[model samples]
Target: MGASRIKWHVVVFLAPAVLVYTAIMIFPLFNTLRLALYSEADQVRAFVGLENFRRLFGDPNWSGAFWNALGNNFWFFFIHMLVQNPIGIALAAILSHPRLRFAAFYRSAIFIPTILSFVIVGFAWKLILSPIWGIAPDMLDAIGLKSLFAPWLGKEEYALTTLALISVWQFVGIPMMLIYAALLSIPEEILEAAEVEGLTGMAAFWKIKLPLILPSIGIISILTFVGNFNAFDLIYAAQGALAGPNFATDILGTFMYRTFFGFQLQLGDPHMGSAIATAMFAIILLGVCVYLFAIQTRIRRYQF
Candidate 1:
């Protein structure tokens, strides 16, 4: 009877959280997926099976925008993976030095931007980059690099890449802090053993510290993937709903927003918007599944 009562208590404790998660997350996700299969026309909504998805992929007008946004999203994510994570790892390595001075201050200073509102960061960068009264040009002029200065935000070729770098600057602290914590968790004795064998400095990190932190790096990679794919607010705040320079900076999130909620002259489209949301959900799910099954499996195989 006592053992049975323990099982009951466990279920009782878990029930509330399960209920809340179902109500808030699971239900809405399934509902959005269902909504994606339906369509509205001439004041009526009807179940349309996979027609919407067909149109999204097969129709020329829809395919172009979808592919463009998808490509840009990939590029945005690539920049972060390339520039942000490596820089974060390097910074974490520097900051984790046992004899480093002002480590706490440096950590706090680096992380402060991550805590600021996305809107604030977006607008702040916009003002600083504005060609008319901005300081970027003047700063470049002072450094004898004025010839390289241009209205990056206004140019199609530069806007997306520029925003991506700004995003990297604002969010590098996340990977830094995460990797920093992972590094600090390493057993000092293992590092000492590595040093005893002539594996010191970069050799120590490359061999000992890095292998143990693979799991943490995997986690950061997936998180960056999800966040970059779902990103909306920063681009919207900086580039507006149009994602302008003629939609050069438009990504999945902004595309979905503009599609579903209607922009300037476009009509609201709940069904089509739901389809976009569904596609985004599928892409994220596919990525996470790939990481879990393929990448993590390989890592574990190599580790063992």
Candidate 2:
């Protein structure tokens, strides 16, 4: 028999996607890395190695902002991880019940926020939460909880966490849907067997369905990490470029934007911006790598 020929058609089919990805993602990533390695002086760009990074970590002026923003970013992510994902899992569990009514309607309503523009969501929430001309205080008063009402967005102690909660409200549907899909994909036979074995209800879910959905949960975790780290639009729209009330809501994304674009009197520093971007990239990459290696590897995929 003659030797089999290589499949040229496969490469042809992939060429367009590859080219587009390279142009939009890979090229920009490498260019940013390259930019991070250089320093600009007197209209001259020079390769200065890790000086920008050193300044980011060592210099008090830069390090303070960098660390604060970074810490806020982590807190933002932690809220979503703790509050959002657990709520999503519970909601998904409830919605995925075979006997549930209006599942479609509920799903659509829950997911509606995810489709809304960040600008609309941010601005709308800002107005709704505003002390002046906002309905929140009135609604709370109606329920006899008026004292709980505060200008959450304006308070430094509450701003970041409140924004994080708002983000959670908008994005919880994502993890719910991912988990719901994973749950639905489980075979009827397995669930039936579990029921027969007296493992119905929450017990069945914890023993059987939960393990099966771990992969999807892991994927959602990584995605959440990436998304939170990359988040900017909502904060920018609601809090402005400063991420104020004393920069309490400042995150890596907004920090990078301010550094790159020069907010107020501060001059734009591309190298420093690139350094921040690189750091963000490294953090995300490290997270993905850890999830893939540590979590995914440990989760056993069952074939049914």
Candidate 3:
């Protein structure tokens, strides 16, 4: 009787959260998936099955945009992986040092941008980088490097890379904090043993600390993947829905938005939009599965 009452209590506690999640997340997700399978003609919806997918993959007009956005998305993810994660790991290592002064202040200062709205970060960066009225050129000129100043966001070759770097600046604190916590959690006894073995300073970190924090690093990497794939707002705010400089900064999110909601002269096609969204979902799922099944397994093996 007591166990039955406890079970009832658990159910009662969980019911509201489960209901809310279903309403907000599960329902919309399944609805989008369903919408992707149908098409509208003369205000009448019809079951088109895989026709939308075929159109997305086979139609040159649709496929070109899709592939462009996808390739840019990959490049964006690559930049975060290449630049952001290493810098984050390095910052975490430096900040986690016992002798470091004002560590709390430094952590807070670095992390403040992460809490700022994407719109604010995007617009602020755009203004700072603007050649006509921006401070970036002035700052470079002050440092005797004015000749290197180009309108980075205005050029197709530099726009996506510039935006990727901006994103890295905004979110690098996350990986830093995660890695910092992981570093702090390492037992003192292990450090003492490592010190006895002459693993001090950089040697200690590379040999002793990094190995134990591999799991945290793996988690941060996967989080970066998911976050980068879902990225839209920053690009949208920075470059508008068109993702211009000839769509150089266009990613899956902006593409989906443009297709789903219609921008300027383009007519909204929810079915095709949902198809694009479904492709994004598939890509994210595949990346996550690979991480969970392959990379995570390897990390576990390395740890054991």
Whole-model Cα lDDT per candidate? 0.91, 0.94, 0.93
The parts of candidate 1 lying over 4 Å away from their true place are: 2-15, 301-304
Order of the predicted models by lDDT, top scorer first: 2, 3, 1
With a 3 Å backbone cut-off (N, CA, C), the pairs that clash in candidate 1 are none
lDDT score, residue 127, model 2? 93
> Each prediction's TM-score against the native?
0.93, 0.94, 0.95
Clash pairs of candidate 2?
none
> Which 10 successive residues of model 3 have the least lDDT summed?
295-304
Better of 1 and 2 by TM-score: 2
Identify the leading candidate in terms of lDDT. Answer: 2
131-243 per-residue lDDT for model 3 (tens digits)? 98959999999999999999999999999999999999999999999999988888888999988988898888888888889988889888988998889999999999999
Across residues 73-128, which tens digit of lDDT does each residue of candidate 2 receive?
A: 99999999999989999999999999899999999999999999889999999999
Q: What is the lDDT of residue 45 in candidate 1?
A: 86
- In lDDT terms, how accurate is model 2? 0.94
Give the per-residue Cα lDDT of candidate 1 at 212. Answer: 81
Instruction: Put down candidate 1 lDDT per residue, 148-178, tens digits, no spaces.
Output: 9999999999999999999999999999999
